[model samples]
Target: MDLSGKVAIITGSGRGLGLAYGKELARNGAAVVINDIDRASADGAVAEIVAAGGRAVAVVTPVGTSEAAGELVATAVETFGRLDVLVTNAGILRDKVVWKMTDEDFDAVIDVHLRGTFTCVREAVLRFREQGGGGRIICIGSPAGQRGNFGQTNYSAAKAGIVGMVRTWAMELQRAGITVNAVCPVAATAMTETIPFLAPHIESMKRGEPLPAIIRRDVGMGTPEDAAGVIAFLASDAAADITGQALSIGGDRLALWSHPQLTATDFHDGGWSAEDIAACWGQTFAGSIESVGEEFPEEVMPK
Candidate 1:
């Protein structure tokens, strides 16, 4: 996808998937703004992009705060003269089962993933309106959120909330030529290194070896570049008509997720009694009530 004159701000782009996205966009001729909390990493990314003959600037700021998010957009506009894409890829993970999860864990994850995405998108929308042109908002999501993970209540909830934001903003911003979408990627990155099942493969890749066919086939393991391709496509003008979608991308796999809707219903005159509802519950919904993590066996699951 060509993004010749576009200016994009990719949060958490100091390294990993966000850095991959910035590099991909820059490679495709878009001016990039790399935002990260780590100053050295952000500067390193900018230096690499510039050395490769791409235009980029590093913005060292935490994305979890409104002021920082606003500064991110302002930096893009001031440096590049216009903003065309905003990728909310900044996030943190704090994993624990509900009972063991602390308030700090839950709040931190939510603040960086959900609230940070909101703040960045809000600022980008304001700039897009001022420019009087279309824009793109690409939010990062995860498979854990789509199918709840065993010990990631906070992380899953935050990612799920991002999809909700995507759908709502897509509708609210369509008239303004803004397309909002989320990419649910399962790539081998620093984030996925925490998964025991994927850690070995990530290490193997880091050592410049090809992953085993079984691991690649089963889990669609690949580098961050694999996911960045999808994000770049969504940021292009070619995807102007596609909005409010949760597209899953990993290696050679790509899939679209279905929105939640009522699958079955039982109705009485006004409302049914508790006893009546309980009597019909099994027949009406039991078969359709899906179990989580049925696709992966227990032995293969991350501990």
Candidate 2:
């Protein structure tokens, strides 16, 4: 996946998973545009990339607005001459149960993860079209999006919406020679270090200690760099035919997540009334009700 001569914009790339992605893309020869709301962090990330012999520039801005999104694309083109890839990785967390979530909390998460992605991808697609219809759009997703996560109503909703758009965009942009896909990644970053189960591992990693296979293989948690390769592959010409897929990667694991589909189907002539459905509810659809979220009982997890 050689990206020589390509230009990429990676939002929220000042640190953590975003920074990892920016570095990997640049390592593969793509000139990167690093974006984040924090000016110091964004500049530091760019300096680090440049120090390591990569071409990189920073655009410090929150990505929810059309103007900011436009600026990111403009920076990529004006600085590097052309834009080839866009990674919508900017996001914020407003974790709360549905009943406890406020309007502000929900809106903040949606604005950054969902609407920011929409605006950024929209701008990138416009550039791709003007440059003659070929580009890559890789949106970040999560396990919460593919299934569900407790006390993460806003996060799950935003992530799920991102994947939803990925599917639609893949179809819409297919003939344009542009590919769209989502990557649901799990990594032990500052954001995940708050989790009780992952805290110790984070510390061990800081001391240069190796993680146990149980944590790495069973939990599928690893350094952000482990997930970065997926971005590099997806951004390369080798993956041009791999659009509309939701691929998960971390630690010793990498898997493809299936799209939502009907588990059961039935035809009712003239449309059956509610009363008619009540009679057969016990045998037909009731048993097929699928469980949602990350359903790992304590007994099943490796300790």
Candidate 3:
């Protein structure tokens, strides 16, 4: 899709998936603002994009703070004339079991992922309204959030919260011509390389080698470009009617996630006592209740 004359901002865009998104958007003719906490990394991204004959500017600012987020939005407008898209991809991970997770760890992840996304979207929407045009807001989500993973309580909560924000904003801003969506991407990035079992495969992929059969079967190996393509599509005009969606992208796979909804319910005219409720609980709810690990069925997962 042609994004000529469009102005877009991508957070944490100095490296990883964010960098890939910025490059792709810029390559598509968008004037991109690269936001990152590291000045050198941000400058490097801008230099690379410019070297490739794409327009891009670096804005070294952390995303969680209101002032910084506002500045990021302001920079895009000042430098590029107007803003058209805001991609919230800045995030951190502090993995630990619930019991071992400290308040600091929990708060840090939430601050960067959830709060940061909120601030950036809020700021961008204000500009979008003033500009009197529709805009796109793409929030980054994680599989850990959709289905809880081991030792990632903080990360999961923050990512899940992002999906909620996307849904709420999508409804609230529909009339304003603003679309909000979330994407859960599985790719071989700096973050995925941390997984012990996936490290060797990730390294091999980096060296342009094929992944092992077992690793390829269990978790399809994909690069940041795989995820960037999906995000770019969501920002294009073709996706104007598609909002409030939680989409997954990995390898050649694309899937839509179902939102939470009522599965089974027991109704009592007055109110059932503890013993009365217990009597029908097994038949009404027990059969539908899923056991641990059932979420990832053996049929779909690695044998």
Per-prediction TM-score, please?
A: 0.95, 0.96, 0.93
Once model 1 is optimally superposed onto the true structure by TM-score, how far is the C-alpha of residue 122 displaced, in angstroms?
Answer: 0.3
- Order of all candidates by lDDT, from best down to worst? 2, 1, 3
lDDT of 2 by residue, 1-303 (tens): 799999999999999999999999999999999999999999999999999999999999999999999999999999999999999999888777889999999999999999999999999999999998599999999999989988888889889999999999999999999999999988988777766667888899999998777767777878999999999999998998999999999888899999988876666789889987987777778888889977543633448
- Score candidate 3 by TM-score against the native: 0.93
Candidate 1 TM-score over all chains jointly? 0.95
Q: Which stretches of candidate 1 lie over 4 Å from their true place?
A: 297-303
- Model 3 clashing-pair count: 0
Candidate 2 global CA lDDT score: 0.92
Estimate the TM-score for candidate 2: 0.96
The parts of candidate 2 lying over 4 Å away from their true place are 297-303
Q: For each candidate in the order shown, give its overall lDDT on alpha carbons.
A: 0.89, 0.92, 0.87
- Candidate 3 Cα errors over 4 Å, as ranges: 212-221, 291-303
